[model samples]
Target: MGRMYGWVAAGLLAGVAQPALAQEADAPSKDSGDIVVTARFRNENLQDVPIAVSVVNGDVAASRNLNTLQDLSTVIPTVDFRNGQSNKDRTVFIRGVGTITTSPGVESSVSTVIDGVVLVRPGQATLDLLDLDHLEVLRGPQGTLFGKNASAGVINLVTKAPSKVQTETLEAGYYEGGEGRIKASVSGPITSTIGYALSGLYASYKGNVFNAGTGHKVNGYDRWGLRGKIVARPNDDVTITFAGDYLYNRDNTPQGVYVSSSRIAYPTGVVTPNATLAGLLAQEGITPSANNKRVNTNFDSEVRDRNYGGSITLDWRLGGGYTLTSITAYREWKNHQTPDWDTRAILATGFPQGRDDGTVDFDQFSQEIRLASPQGGLVDYVVGAYLLAADTYERYQRSVTQLIGGAPVTNNGVANYGISAQNHALFGEANLHATDALTFIAGGRLIHDSLSYFHQRVSDTATGVSGIRPSFASSGKTDRVDYSARAGVQYKLASNANTYFTFSRGYKGPAYNVFFNMQAFDTQPLAPETSTSYEIGLKGSLFGGRVSGGIAAYVTNYDGYQANFADTYLGAIVTRLINAGKVQTKGIEADLNARPTDRLTLNFAVARTDARIKHFNCPAATTCTSIDNQPLPFAPDWKLSGGAAWKLPITDGLAIELQTDASYKSRTQYAITQTPDTIQPAYGIWNASIALIGDEHWELRALVKNILDQHYANTLAYGTTAGVVRYVPRDNDRYVGLNARIRY
Candidate 1:
């Protein structure tokens, strides 16, 4: 950690001589020009905000073919996400901080907010990000203003809104291997005081992997989405906006490519395959393959997801130089998945050798009201109140089947769980300008959170199995009050150059471990996790708004740290959350842009993170061991990314553009208690694109992804008996595509 900071200090000192210039202009900004963001709850120049945030424009996403969380993580430093037992369930991590449990009782430390509305579950973050105006990545604790669950950070998505001008855009593209996609959007004025916009998208791709066992293609993808928006301005002082959207995704389950081991552990430390496993494999006509990309499963594996939502926002100006804003939103998400947990056609020990089902149904509602004094005052203030209500239902089913005396025996078991939660918060912030160049900010939030949970299991087996838990029923309720606060001071040395330091405390309410191993549900409530973060940085514009960026360093300390432990029960893999004691995370981040010439632009960003458990003692439940000083899982030590864009004019109405970007990550750990087998080697990826623009609102583009064709696993894990198993569910290979667009 000391050596990592040494380089960061030297780099900052080297750039100290560069002259910094003023506030960013409001002209149309692209790749590296005067980036603007809403990280501070208002539209402000990125370089002026005293926070560490990365803003990516919609044009950049369109040119780079970035449509998924994995793709977005590549360009942003200190961000990563992985699939859970079900691919639809995504777990996002920032700065080595995130949740590993996908159970209904657990919530993610990282928050995903779209247009000021926060999502309730990690699965909701997997929805397709479309028609986005910009994406903002805020690092460090943000609970003081956003919410209590934003203990790690926040990802904000802002979509394009209705426009007054009449316009339409159409685009189509084809990738290698017969995949096709199309997008359309139209917006215009409907009346003197109203405007409307409509947009839709559809895409499909043939799977790359073939299932020899079932003689069907595996891992195919199908997606569709639609959005409608309306904006009304009845008077000069009142404005209202209504937005609604629906997205559907259906894809084959990305089962772990089997490597080895399929047996339940016994008390005597003996392992053996299922009694009738060999016969069942033969009956299913499955031939074992050594290739990792091949699928050899007997059961059907797929995931179907539906996400829809709507929000209405009202902004009104009142008497006495004040403005009022109100927001109301409701959303629902449902996912059904059948995953081949065993990854093989053969059965293990129990009656149902391979797992069959998992489901999650979630609904959420939110409202926020805010009143603020107009700008241009020595002391400015904003006060707000927020409320959220959510409900979730989860179910899991197991197919209990075995071959007895050459005859097939079958039974079924089901587990059902429910959780309901409500949260109320009052938050306010005020800015005090002491001098012309010095300003102070302070904010705080008071939140009351409550939730109820219930779980039930049903089965006919009278005798309990050695490794599996029997049917049981349990219910519990928990409630708590959490508080978060923030304080910061900014000093401006010149019109454009400024440096600031901030201290913030964030809180996350207690969560349950709903995925019971039958080892008891920890009737006692789990302790809530809390973090104190300190950050200092320098940011400013330069070269007349053509070049702008920032450098920041932050350190965070955690109490009652939460982490995961993976274990096997009844020949099936399961994960459990534990209070892993105190942990500390320290990191340095730097970003810069240079537009030496009007036609060429370059940008660079780098981050180094060191997250480790400071203290942890073994628990009394099992033979668990202490993991002191161990680095957190999925936290990379170093990440570097950069890009360059160059444009050339051909004629008065035509132009050509070339853009390229690349990223490299250092060795990362997949298990908190790291082992030689759990470490992922360092890897890099590159993307390049070329485009041509015409005078009549027409454009053509060509893009290549993973130019080196790296065959690295997105998520890698290794076990004693299982050599290696990875969740390489999608896009592990290189891709080439061409797209064309027309606008009127």
Candidate 2:
């Protein structure tokens, strides 16, 4: 992102050089233009909200420290994540569309939603970093208003509430490799209508940025979090709020050791791990040879996660403008992984192994109610109701042993499972007018899904007579109901010029964790994939509101698709999810945010996509002639991003903030005759940050990410392994320092 558009064009050119060097000649204006967002739920004014949303705040996500959610797409230009040797992986795409599956029973095509609940798995999407109040990147295919898994779009995380008067904050920081962090918050008023708030955070890191030569010790990452809130407005119209959060992390992710290999060839492409097969540990007594040399010397691994959630919100104001809203939520999450798959056999001998332990558990429940109508007659309204329930199960086993010289003959691996789902929904939206430059918009959603999967496994030494068994409740259980709708039209040549057309009927609800994988003594269940989308757009503002832009075009149709393979059932080598057949997609997108003066401001976005498979028959397209048409694994058919920020306030708590960003995308192949192990090449990187607020009660910031350490790769193979050796980390260097405000 061209170092984030050169730090926002050097803080709007030092705030246009402090009033053109007139030495602040007449202060008083922080209008701070643009930055009004609600991501369609009515709050309009995001240049009129036709769609394609993106808003950032919470002080630019905490002065760019960005904490979690894997750094939110290097400044939000569609988003990205997929890293080395698997760190619980993730895949997200918008505009070009996307779906991710790694077989813990698949599920996730974007739909993170926090503050309105709905965080459907991926270990609840890496939490922590609170005290926020903005983050909405809406985009496309919200399945008629965000239905089951969203089909590639929706990430609304809004926080920051619980202040009735008394407020406080405190923060500390240090960074430049060996990291550190601290945070605190407070809010008051426990009477006269009630209120309360509390927050806490702590972060730690070592995550060694690589100096590689293969070794024996490398520390990992660590984190911690806590949040709480409560509010009540008793009388005058009714309002209530409650919230809770907790996070725990232990990342120690080291995985960097793959010095040599060859059976099919690792020849320096590296995938290391065969510490002489633990030298058969004394030929199998159990433990010898100095406790089996710490189990193959630290091949890089450490993961542990614990997340928590809670939410409640209500606001009622009945009269004239009409309003009523309610939200309820629940969540529980867990993750624990032990990695170190052997780095050149623990660096040729010194050893390191915490053993291969893995586990996961996530639970969720949600409820929503809504109603709002108001805005000068010709009609404007919104209504909603939704209910969702989730029960989750996940676990994988590992106890790789051979150790002849150290001792433990044979014990391979396999243990996996998942089942539970229940859902319901009702929704509506309207905006109509007959004349005066036309206007009409409509929306709908009515969906219900009920599912329960049965069958569990413990694999008794690869089917050599296991003890526990029960398969898919005798193969009977499945239910689905789907509906979607949307219509749009707008025409106006003044009032900031307008032109819009839309047709949406998106619905996705196969979500039994993305298709099937059989083997719970027989598996069957993988169906549900649907879509319909078409759009048109134009919105303009020139010279006056200081030039703004928009342009859109789209088409999508997907009948069904779900394929994942790497078979070896009775012999154990997991990963299977099938049912692949139809698909169609098309696209064009555009964006601009100009500010020709007032000391410069510019922003841009562009995209072009073409997806294929008019009919797929799998197993190498089976006579479908594999027209794979390439460029869709990590979809990047062409994209661009722009940025600029400049400001200066030498007086009044001294201010200096400059920013930047630039981007490009093209090569990203995963098949279709482009093999060189299915491509991924094309890179760009740049970044910067600086801040000093010191007394709105103290605030200081500094950040530099990638800066230009470019090594590009953020998505590729996951489970069904044919060997890709994972590498999607484009952050080679980063430095951070922050401190924040308002009474300690």
Candidate 3:
């Protein structure tokens, strides 16, 4: 089925290839308009870039109510986002490749960059985006220019700049389930040479999960943030910009909900009821169900996160049309969480039963300098150097009570871990115009990484439980150097159309599994991951600005893919990161935007991905089965998204607008082992909105999300003692809301 779609896409590319129309000039029509992008570190027309990229304009995002990366994933079929126990564990995937782990020493394969500053941790990008100018998602490896940790791809976000004219904006919204939000911003010129912008936001939600024990909502949040920017011209030849932001978030959402008590036998593919877990649940008068919406926990979970950052940028126009750019940045993230591990209201002989508290502190400093030659020459180039230094510290404490020989017993333990890292890189890219109709592109990066870790564990009392481990201390260090490169050629089929093919090499640094449960064997540094990818794409416009879009096909293979698998630690089920063997992902993607008339617009996107394991290096002392051909977790075979908008004039001073969007994905497996209990069935969601707009001052909108009230899990997993558990998302139920905005 996937092969068929690939062929169809290839045919479409061929059909669009036509001889250059000498009558038509080699430039885009004025009616088509132009989208400017910095995908290659320079402003260029989107259709001219030889890469597979997608753009989301800020105005379109505002109308769709997209507030975070997770929200953006629904409209981009080639990307996927997953949430975990807390913000620190969230993960993002592009082209079926991503790293999933809680170790601070490890970096994500997919990187996030905001306003030219790369984020040290993926969790830092989870904050609500505000006043965005636009967003770009680049598929496949992007390490040649973006640098390390971009082996899979990159998500680039650009915020609105300070305005030359004075402006003030205010917005307020209220949704079902007691969710409310307010936002305001002001921008203008401070002087003839200096301009400034300031924005602030506040939001609150009264969760959806019902806590049967406490008679209150369990998964709710309160968030607020502030951002400011200043731009100064200084002189006709130089420009300086400064930016800073701070955010605070607090929530009480548990790791997951108990969904079932079914267990599967290891290595035999047998399913049966977990009698032991069922007996324990019955003691507390609890029954597990697939549609479970209530949880009886004795304690409330708490997660508090604080993030802040600042950056300074300098751009200088040198002699002979040469440009020099420098950027320096510093950022910090601190998080503290208290979770109820047991998820039950059982009475025990302890002050606080079945609870764990953890804290993390991370900081990073980075500097980048680059120079670029002027465009429209036979040969143009960009060269850059990057340096990064980062450190992370974590502290964890666990307390639990269990029945030992018909008597209640209590146990307590604590663990501390720290990691330090440094990275340096030199990168460059150049384009050679062999002819007016043909061009060649090449880029490469040389990177060096140094990483080290320290860890210690201590127990307050000796217990007979098999899950307890002896006190221990461990440390390790590693260093390595690697390189990534890309080569491609593009041919202009016509004035408004082009075709290109490229090969890329991607690399990710080595890592250590330095977590709370780290043992002697885990001290060894895991092998670095590497990949090679091949891609062919075509981009163009048709019908004299009526249609514009792109189509691409890609295949990527990875060695030493980093993933989490189920294992046994001291007679208890546990999950740990390992260098899972080889994996390959091949797919076809297409996106289209059309303006049939001045009153209507339509957009569509689709992806057919086949991500599978080519080899499995089964870890010793672990349950092993047939998994060589299993699909990677969170990867679906097919994904699609489409939307439409229509504008109707009510009068000379007012108008009515209608919009709707829909998305769908095939079934997904949530575990590497392909366990039946960890499968999420296929699902789809639909949303629509109606708005009334004034000439240029104010607007009101009414929106409905999850129109079908689809009930599905965001993710599924096997619990150590609770059998199967699932994460319930906020959109599992239908909801409606109203938003209002004023501009002056």
Q: Which is the leading candidate under TM-score?
A: 3
TM-score of each: 0.90, 0.33, 0.93
What is the TM-score of candidate 1?
A: 0.90
| Top candidate when judged by lDDT against the true structure | 3
Error of 1 at 643 (Å): 1.4
Model 1 C-alpha lDDT per residue in residues 1-744, reported as the tens digit of each score: 443344344334323211111112244355346667778676677777788987776545764666766667877877877754454456888998988776677678898898888887878877567777778889998887785488899988888877668999998888876677888999989998999999898988777666666877666778999988899999988989999999998887556553332332322334454335444444554332223566567765788888999999998989677889898999999888887655566654443444668788899999989888776578877789999999988888765565557666655667798788898999988788888789898989998989888888775554533223677778788999988888999888788788999998988888777753334644445678899999999998777767677899999998987667766554445556777788888999988777778777777788899988888745445565566887888789998777676779999999987777767678887776565445567776666678898985998989887666655666665421233455553456778999888999
Name the regions of candidate 3 deviating beyond 4 angstroms: 1-31, 265-269, 279-287, 347-353, 461-468, 570-572
Which window of 10 residues has the lowest lDDT sum in candidate 2?
18-27
What are the per-residue Cα lDDT tens digits for candidate 2 across 633-735? 5556665556566666688667775665555556665432223433556554555566666546666667676564555445433212112333324254344
- Candidate 3: minimum summed lDDT over ten consecutive residues — where? 17-26
Higher lDDT: candidate 1 or 2? 1
Candidate 3 CA-lDDT value: 0.80
lDDT of 3 by residue, 1-744 (tens): 553354334324322211110111113443555566788998777778998987887645764567778778877888887877678778888987888888888888898998888997788888788777788898998998885678889898888889879999898888899888888999999999999999998988888877777787877789899989999998898989899999888888866777887776544768888676666556755577665666677777788989899999998999787899998999999999897776767653221246789999999999999999998899999999999999999998777677656687767778899899999999999999999879999999999999999999897554323334557799989998998899999999998899999999888889988777676778888888888999999999888756777899999999999887777653445667789999999999998777777777777788999999999888656657869978998889988777677778899979987777777788988788888778788877777789899986788989988776777787788764547877777777889999888989
TM-score of candidate 2 on Cα atoms, chains taken together: 0.33
